[model samples]
Target: MFTGIIEETGTVTGVIRHADLWRISVAGPAVSADAAPGDSIAVDGVCVTVTAPPHDGVFIFDVSAETWRRTTMEEWRAGTRVNLERAVTPATRLGGHLVQGHVDARGSLTDRRESGAAAELTFCFPEKFRKYLAQKGAVAVDGVSLTVAKLTRDTFSVAVIPHTLGLTTLAEKKPGEPVNLEFDVIAKYTESLLQFRGTGERELSEDYFSERGF
Candidate 1:
């Protein structure tokens, strides 16, 4: 798992297409410093395994046709700046919320405005994921954990600090750009459990709640 904390920004150096498969190379110093062939890396919030050991600060990953269909990978090209984060270790600090590096859905930047010294970016996401979002809740946008500053029926906004803007790709983001999104895993799990209550899989009812003193 990842912590939704961007360690560095990587640039797509190349994209080689072989039929429906794509082999992508990203060059980043910090993320590739100790990366191995089998290590997991979050590239723009999508967990991709390193195809081989780093070569001159670059790592390669293969994207299958199905992964391409489900993500914004089709929009990526050479020179695309992407957020990169290595998987978290047991001893690592939880600087951000737990991130599976699994993109639940894709969103697009709808608006951007300056809020004091921060940039407030509003994004329109899939309507089905709306129920998982709440004001001040955690959400991963392109692998960067951010709090929901505001929420609407199909949109949410986050205030990006100058530091965040400088260290990651958000500084170069513009309106209408596609972004990978991962909603809070806890919220999704809770919703699933509630939906399956008393189905013999597990009971989640008044008795269950009272037992837990909820």
Candidate 2:
């Protein structure tokens, strides 16, 4: 798991395509400092395994066809900058919300408005994922954990502070650019548990808890 906290920005050095997967090499000295061949790294919010040990501050990852189809990895090319984060350890602080590094769906930036030194970016996401979003809820965009500052029928906005903008790739993003989005895992799990009511189970409600002596 990841904390959706970007450690640094990495540059894509090379991309080699094959029939089944594409080999991608990224240069991120900080994130790859102690990375091993099997370590999991979040490249722009997508969890990719290090295929080879770091060499000269470069790390290799293989993107499968399925991952490519569901993410913006296809748009990546040489010299592209991407947010990078290493997986969290047991002792690691939960700086941001829990992020699986699994891109649920791709979204696009719809608007950007400057707010003093910060900026609010609005993105339109898939309709299926709309139910999982709420005002002030946590969401990971391109692996940067942010809170929903506002919400609309088909869009949500996040406030990006100067620090986040300077450290990650959000500062370089423009309207209409595609972004990888990972909704809060807790929201998804809650929805899944509520769906169990369809299996002839009792509906979950305040009275259910009250009756249980809560």
| Candidate 2 lDDT score relative to the true structure | 0.95
lDDT for each residue of candidate 1 in 1-214, tens digit (9 for 90 to 100): 9998899999999999999899999999899999999999999999999988898999999989877877888899999999999999999999989999889999999999986767999999999999999999999999999999999999999999988888888887899999999999999999888778747664656887788889
Q: TM-score of each candidate?
A: 0.92, 0.92
TM-score of 2: 0.92
Clashing pairs in 1: none
User: For candidate 1, which ten residues in a row score worst on lDDT?
Assistant: 196-205
Q: In candidate 2, how many Å is residue 173 off? A: 0.4
